[model samples]
Target: MQSWLDVDPTSDFSIYNLPFGVFETRDRAPRAGIAIGDYIVDLAVLAERRLLPLPDHAPHREEDLQRALNRPTLNDFIALSKSVTGAVRLCVQQLLMASSRDAHPPEVWAHALVRQRDARMLMPLRVPNYTDFYSSLHHATNVGAMFRDPKTPLLPNWRHLPVAYHGRASSIVVSGAPIRRPRGQIKRDDDPTPTFGPTLALDFELEMAFVIGKASPLGRPITTSEAEQYIFGLLLFNDWSARDIQKWEYQPLGPFLGKNFASTISPWIVTLEALDPFRVPMPSQEPPPLPYLRASGNQSFDIHLAVDLIAPSGLTLTVCRSNFRHMYWTMSQQLAHHTVNGCNVEVGDLMASGTLSGPTPESYGSMLELTWNGRNPLRLPDGSTRTFLEDGDAVALRGWAERDGMRVGFGEARAQILPALDGEA
Candidate 1:
C-alpha cells in the first residue's frame, strides 16, 4: 500500500486508508476529497482531469463515475453501489502506487493535492434523518443501574429489538463545532416545581455512526442480510446530553429537546471496504432474534474507541476506553429493525451506535456513568474534580483499528463546550 505521496506511518490518513470528506479551499469551491496523509486529494479535480480510472473488475461507466466524484457532498457517490465506491478507492490506490512507472505526470499531483491546513472541512453529506440507537448492552445497563434499580438494569424489550430514537438532523454538526450548553426545564429533587434554565449536567456520549448509502422505498423493508448494501461507512459520533433535562422530560415518550441540541461527528467517513480486514464475528444473541434480525456474516468491527476530556486549565484525562465490538446489536440488525415496519431510509442518513460502553467502570461512555451522577467525581490532573463537563471544557472522541500493522482510523470528533447564552436562562 506504499504511495508516492509520503504518508506518516502513524497518521490516521495512511495510504491504505483513503477516507472521504468534504472540504473548502481558499481558491476553490467546496468539493469532495480523500485523505492521504496531511494532504487531501481532491476527487473533483481528479474526475475533471480524467485521472480516476474505473477498475477492471468493476464495469461502471466513466460518465457515472465522473458525475458522482464531482459532487459537493459524498451523498451521490456513496449512493452508488458499494462496488462503485470500492472501484474508486482502488483507482486512487493504483494512481498513488504509480511511482515505479512514470504513468502520470508530476503536474497531476500538484493539481490534485491540497494541504489539509489550507482546507476547511465541511459535513460530508446532507443528512436527511438521524437515528441514535441504544445498541450497547453495557451502556444500557450502566445507565439503568444508575437511574433505575441496580438489580433489574436492562428493560424487558431491550434484548428483543434494537431500541432507537429519531434524532434532530439539523443539529448534527461536524467536528470542531462549538457546542453550547442547552437551556431546558429541570425539576430538582428538593424543588416541587420545574424551572427553566441552562442545564447543570452536560455530558458527552462516545459513539460511532454509520452512513446510509442506498435509498429504500417507503413501504419496502430492508432485511438483515441486505442492510450492508445500504451502508456507506463509519464515523466517530459524540451525542451530547443534558442529564437534568432528560431526567425531567423522558417518561412515556423518548428523548426530545434534552438529546437534540447538538451531536458532533468526525469529518472523514471510513469506508466499509477499508475496514473489512478488521471485521469480527457478531456477538451471539441470547433469545434468538426474529428471522428478519438474524445475520449470517461477520457484522462487527473491532475498532478501539477512547474519550478524552481536556479541562480549561490545560489538563486532560482519558475518561473512558471502549470498543465498537461492545455493541450488543450490530449495524445490520439496527437497520433491519428500523425498516422492518416499512420505515424508509435515504442516502446520507446517519444511524449512530448509542454510547459504546464496555463491561468495566473505565469503559463507561458518558460523564453521567463515569462520574456516577456526581457522587463519584473524577479527579483531573489540574487538581480539580469534575462531576460533569464545565464551561470551556473540550471533549474529544477518537477511534481506530489496527490489525497486522495495517491501521484505519476515524479522526477525532472534538468540541469545546461554551457557556449558555446570557438571555437563554
Candidate 2:
C-alpha cells in the first residue's frame, strides 16, 4: 500500500495500517482519526468535506458516518456492520494511496491531515467493561509454579477454560498517564498481620487487548465463529500489578485494589483488517475444548511484543521479549468462554490476553516472573537492578504485527511510577 504520505519504511503506522484513535487539537474537541504516517487524517473532517471515496451502493449513510466520526469515541462507527467499516477503511486507503493521490483535489489533503505529534490523544472509546483473561499457557504456568505447587502448577479448570477475572474498567487509562504507587493491604512474609501502605512490589505485565466492535443481545451468546465480527482491533496493554497486595488478597476473591488502581493502554486501535495478513494457526489443544469453544481456522496473530524498563536517570533495559502467538488459548476461545454462559458483550468493551509470556525465561511478561519474586534481580544498562518497579521507574510496552515487509503496530503504553499519596486512611 503505497501512500503519498512520507512514512518511514520501518514506521509502525505504515500506509497498510490506518489504525484509529481519538485526538484533540488545541481549540477543537476530540474527533476520530486514523494514523497514516507522521500525520493523522481526521475522519470527521474528511466526511465533512465529502471526500470519502464512498461507492454508489454503500450500505451506510454519509451523514451517519460523519456524525459517528465527529463523536469523541469510535464506538458508534465500530458498532456498524463489518461491511460498513470495511468500506470506510477502503475509502481511506484509496484516498491516501500515492497513485490515487494525484486523482484527488488538493483540498482532500489540506482539510484532513493533522501532525501526529501536535494532536493530544484521548481514549479511543469509553470502555463499558474490561476483562483480563489468563490465556497464555506459559505465563499462567510460570506464575503458578512460582506461587503454587511447582508439580501441579496449573489449576484444574485452566486446561478446560479460559480463566479470567472481571477488571475495573473505570481505572483504565490511555498511555502516558502517570501511575501512582497504589496503597493496599500487604502482609509481610515474616509478619502475621496485614498493614496498609504503598506497595513495593509494583510490576508491569505486557499484554494485548481487543476492543469489541459489535454488541450482542442480552441473553444471546456469541459463538466462537461469530466472535471475530464483534472484535474491532488490538492495542498494547499494561496490567500493572501490586504483587505484595495481590499475594495476600487474590486467593479468596481475586484481584481487587491490587489491580484496580491502574491499567494502561495504547491510544491507536489497529483494525482487524490490518492484521488479517498476520494471522497464524493457533496452537493445538491437547484436551480438546468443549463444542462451543472449538474454533476451526487461523485464529492467532503473530504480534511481536516487548517491554522496556527505564530508570530515573534514563538507563533503559529491554527486559522481556515475547510474542502473542505463543499463547496457548486463542482470542476466539477466550471470547467464546466469556459468553458461553449467556453474558452479552457490548461495543467498546475491552478484553485482554493476560500477560503474553513466551516459552523461555527471557520471555517472561512481568517483573514477578522475570525476577522470580526478587530472588533474582534484572541488571539494567547502568548497573542498576530491578526486583520490581520502584519510585520513578518507567515501564513501556510496545507491540507490532509484521510480515512480508508490512507492519501494523500499537505505538506504546507507558507509565512512570510515582510516590504514593502523603496520607491515606
Residue 73 lDDT, candidate 1, scale 0-100? 83
Point to the candidate with the largest lDDT: 1
Q: Return the TM-score for each candidate structure.
A: 0.97, 0.98
After superposing candidate 2 on the true structure, give the runs of residues whose Cα lies further than 4 Å from its correct spot.
Answer: 53-59
Worst 10 residues of 1 by lDDT: 97-106
Q: Candidate 1: global Cα-lDDT?
A: 0.90
For model 2, residues 1-425, the per-residue Cα lDDT tens digits are 78888899878899888899999999668998999878998898878877764566666788888888888988988876677777777888888888887886787778689998889999888999999999889988988898889999999999899999999999999998999999989999899899999998999999999999988888788888888988989999999999999988987899988899999999999988999999899999979988999987789988999999989998888999999998888888898889988899999999999999999999999999999999999998667788999999999999888888898888999989999998977
Q: For candidate 2, give the lDDT of residue 258.
A: 87
TM-score of 2: 0.98
Q: List pairs with backbone clashes in candidate 2.
A: none
* Candidate 1 per-residue C-alpha lDDT over 41-134 given as tens digits, one digit per residue, 9 for 90 to 100: 8888888888777666765677877777767788888876777787778778778873643777778778889999999999999999999999
Query: Among all windows of ten consecutive residues in candidate 2, which has the lowest summed lDDT?
Result: 51-60
The runs of at least 3 residues in candidate 1 whose Cα sits more than 4 Å from the true structure, single-residue gaps closed, are 55-64, 98-101
Give the distance in Å from residue 214's predicted Cα in candidate 2 to where it truly belongs.
0.6
